[model samples]
Target: MPFVVPRSPELPAATWGSYGMTTLAVVPLIWRRRAPVAVLAAIVLIGGVYKVALDGPGQPLPYAGLIAFYTVALQCAPRVRVAVGLATVAAVALSVGWKTGTARELLFTLFVSAAAYALGRLQYTRQAYTEAVEARAAELERANRIEAEQAAARERARIAREMHDILSHAVSIMIVQAEAGPVAVRRAPERAEAAFEAIAETGRDAMAQLRAMLGVLRTAEASPRSPQPGVAELRELLERVRASGPRVSYERTGSVRELPAALEATVHRVVQEALTNVVKHAGASAVDVRLEYGAESLTVTVTDDGRGPGGSSSGGHGLIGIRERAAAHGGTAQTGPGPDGRGYAVRVVLVTSPQEVGT
Candidate 1:
């Protein structure tokens, strides 16, 4: 293809040499990103040679030079860019003087070069901003995923504690009643019927609580909406233990006011766990449950006239769950021999105010 430009006495005609020079000037652009300054230098040198030696038809635009300059502006350090820019300005001035010797052409060429440089810098800024935004988004996604996993773990622990307390207590009571049922049948038929009835009642209660929990897990529409066992349910819980042949007593101190539902539920669970330990480990005949409400705390104490803290009840999941529950509520749990070291006692102090509870 022929190079086309207006025929002027000063402008040389298009030649095969001019086309070859143009191709050479553009070829170096392939390595522009890796060695931008070198690429620009090559283009300038080729263009200068084509101008002075061949005096070929002038390009409408210095496309090769502009592209190389843009790459340099984008990829080079500030010191290199400044040094190259000054050299380019001197070259532009000399080229214009040697060609048309006109200020208008020189200004136009400078403006075009500056625009290319500006565009290169603008592109660099935009890319940097985009990368920063993407990095931040990734960090947030990781944080959210971690939080979700932690929440899932906490929920699983809670479910395990609930199931253990419910099933363990229910099964222990039923076992005791079932064992007594045969003995009572051989002695008093009336007591035998009561023991059997107690077993059935305990089983039904456990099933109801378990079903309620599983219903929520299954996303069932008809899931029982009843709140967890709270203070109002403590009496019934004591009665169940009483049926298993233990003399259980309940006492309250301080201002007996309604507490938060969560706190009350914890209270209920703590008492149940303690009584279970007593029934399972302690061979005591009598157990006492006391609730003492303080200014900003509620203390639950379960003391049994058992054989002291030994066996699985000393450091079991039951005790661990109690400690976890207390810590969650910004409270504490203490266990050891009861007063005078006669039996075992588990006491948990729980924060009552909602604001005081830990997350």
Candidate 2:
């Protein structure tokens, strides 16, 4: 058997019908956010004409037209907005005759539409401005984070270079003294005793420089010592390491100038760390250290003659520590066999003026 479809119940007439239709027109306003132009156009075409057709003394459809007009004015571009405003005024003028329409009614409708439009416009402008501000803030934060990462990398490299320079020189001196200590004692006990004394003094100096350089790695609060070290201290570091065993040499290529406190610390740390690694890892050997201070940046290199300790193949705590120090200052560290194919070499480069550190 075929089933019959039910029809929608008929709407009642009177002020109620007009009121219901007016309410139906207002429904489109909810879609104003998604499709403002379309909703406004539909309300104007349907609601506007309905009010004119109803032409009764008290029709509610006019209120729907006012709502549509307000939406158009607020959401549409200036040109379209002006056109919508004119159209709304014309609709009202036509529906309510010039002679019969009271001045009070006309003013009230205009005032309501204008008020609604102003409110909608204020809301839209505030939301748009807020989003733009949030986006810009996020972008700045991202840039700052990237810069911080780069600085940290550089600082680690500097520390590694310093360690290599200090250790390589110290170990070379110690080895030479150790070998000569026995020979000199057999031949001349006095000379041997002097050599041993020199060795002890050099060890003390290396320890001091190592502490100072390492202190920079710790947080400011953690490190109570003042922040500053430069090429001047490099000489003392070289002397101590030289006494350890290896015959070491140092040369400054460019005009050495005072550097920023942080940078000075960075340079000292790099040389210190590099030398430490050389003494610990490289066997008995000779080492050479070079420092070049250019207008833009500084470069340090440490080379030793001990048999290749093999590339630092796996990253250990020391390597990680070195890397962290370099990154903090926007520098880099690289370790490998020396160019002469005998021992390990470490090189570090850093900018003189680094970005400010984060709190």
Candidate 3:
């Protein structure tokens, strides 16, 4: 552009040396982001040489130098930026004072440089803020996903426990009755009828409970919800077990009151599993079921005058399910020999109130 236009009579003419120096100042800008302070220094040095030695045709704005200074403000550390900024200001003041010797030109150059630096600083702040927000959002998403997976695992475990209790108890009773049916028929016809009837009743009850569980699992919204067995159903559970042959008794102590549905269900399952263990493994003649309700807790204990702890395996899973049920409500289950070390016993203690649990 300087070559195309004529220069002022007072100023030096455009020359090849001046054009080369101007090109050299602009070329270093390509590496400004990687070495911002170095790029700025190189541009300032080239401009100084052009002004002093080559006396280049002047530009309206030092475009390459301003761009390099802006990059330095954005990319360089605070200490480096401050040092380089002060040096550039001093150099600009000297250069302006020597060339035009006017305060207006010096101030104008300083104002533009300051504005460019301010814009760069604002850009860096905005970029940092955006990165922080994105990181926070990602962390929250990961936490939610982990929580959802844990909830799913808990539900699966609950379903497994329920299935084990229902099937094991029902099958044990039916086996006892079916085995005794032939003997009863040989002696008393009426006793034989009752034994057969007990088998049918047990099968139907098991089927109903299983259906309710499966219905909820398949599609809860479209399935009828059934109330799970609780403390009130223990009498019936005992009756069925008694008909199987072993003498069964139920006793409740302490202040008897309604419990949370979940706790009641847990109690019922614990007693059922313990009795199933006696009927299937322990060859006991008498079984005792006891419930002692407290101010903030309930304890269910099933003791049988059967074989000791080593007698009943409870299929290994039943006892584990019992323990898990107790632990769910912040409680515990223990299994060992009964009173006088005569038979096996399963004793479980559970918290009644939700607020008092795990306290």
Candidate 4:
């Protein structure tokens, strides 16, 4: 570009030294982002030397020096930014020689230097804003992912609890019925038939409850809805227990008020688990199932005049499940000898508020 066009026709031709200085000034710019201050100093030194040795500033401006000024504005400290920009403007002014040029040309060269610095400042600000926005978005995405995982974990725990409740009660009844069915068949065929019928009924009930609970995992378009039985299903639960275990007498005390669906279901499960324990471990002749509705709470007590609990040694989770269910509904459960010191008793008291029931 030795014969390249000039800014004005009257300007002198570019010398070999000028070309070398321009190359030295610009070549280090490749590393400007990594070493901005150093790159700027190198360009300034080259431009100064070229100005001193040459006749005057060439027709074209010192583009390399201007770029270095802008880079300094973007990457250096505030004091360094001012010094570097001024140095660039002064270099331009000195090379062109103010005594030789008109005020218009001098002003135009300074303006160009100042504009580059301003543009660099704009680039730095824009890049900084974009990076901040991206970081915020990433943080929000991380929080949402954590919340989603927590919800999924809670749902899995609920499903496991429901399944445990169902299997413990249903399997206990079936086991007792199976053990009694053969003995009764030899003594009274009709009694054996009734036992088998009870076993089948219990299986059907368990299947329905399981389908209802597990349906949440499937799409609505595929699985049919199965409504879970709550308070009203107590009678059915008692009926299922009759053939396999001692007679269960159910009594309701206090003013009966409608409970939340979750409360009702929890109570039903507590009773079911308690009764199953009696049949599996107590060997008691009879059990009392009492439901008391209070102003602010619903209480249920299941007591059996049996030998004692023998299922804990057999890996039974009946009592643990009962306590877990009670706590899930903001309730407390206690297990010990009945008040009369005659048999085992499971007493559960649950709060009546909607929030307590977690509806």
Candidate 3: RMSD to truth? 3.0
Descending-lDDT candidate ranking = 3, 1, 4, 2
Report lDDT (Cα) of residue 314, candidate 2: 32
Give the alpha carbon lDDT tens digit for every residue of 252-320 in model 2.
Answer: 888688776766766666666666665656663688889888776677888887766563323244555
Q: Write the per-residue lDDT of candidate 4 for residues 103-204, one digit (tens) a residue.
A: 787888788877988899999999999999999999999999999999888778767767887988889899999999999999999999999999998899
TM-score of 4: 0.82
lDDT of 3 by residue, 1-359 (tens): 66677767888777777777778889999999999988999999888887777776745249888898888888889999999889989988998999997999999999999988998899889988999999999999999999989988998999999999999999999999999999999999999999999999999999999988988899937554578899899999999999999999889999999887888899999999999999999999999999998888899999999878778754489999999999999999999999998898899999887687746
Q: List candidate 2 stretches off by more than 4 Å.
A: 1-16, 49-67, 102-104, 179-200, 212-359
The 10 consecutive residues of candidate 3 with the worst lDDT sum are 52-61
- Candidate 1, clashing residue pairs? none
lDDT of 1 at 89: 95
**Per-residue lDDT over 17-50 for candidate 1, one digit per residue giving the tens place of the 0 to 100 score:** 7777778888998999999999999889988887
lDDT of 1: 0.88
Instruction: Give model 1's clash tally.
Output: 0
User: What are the candidates' C-alpha RMSDs?
Assistant: 2.7, 9.5, 3.0, 3.7
Residue runs of model 1 more than 4 Å from their true location after superposition: 1-11, 58-60, 220-225, 312-315
How many clashing residue pairs appear in each of the predictions shown?
0, 56, 0, 0
lDDT, candidate 1, at 313:
61
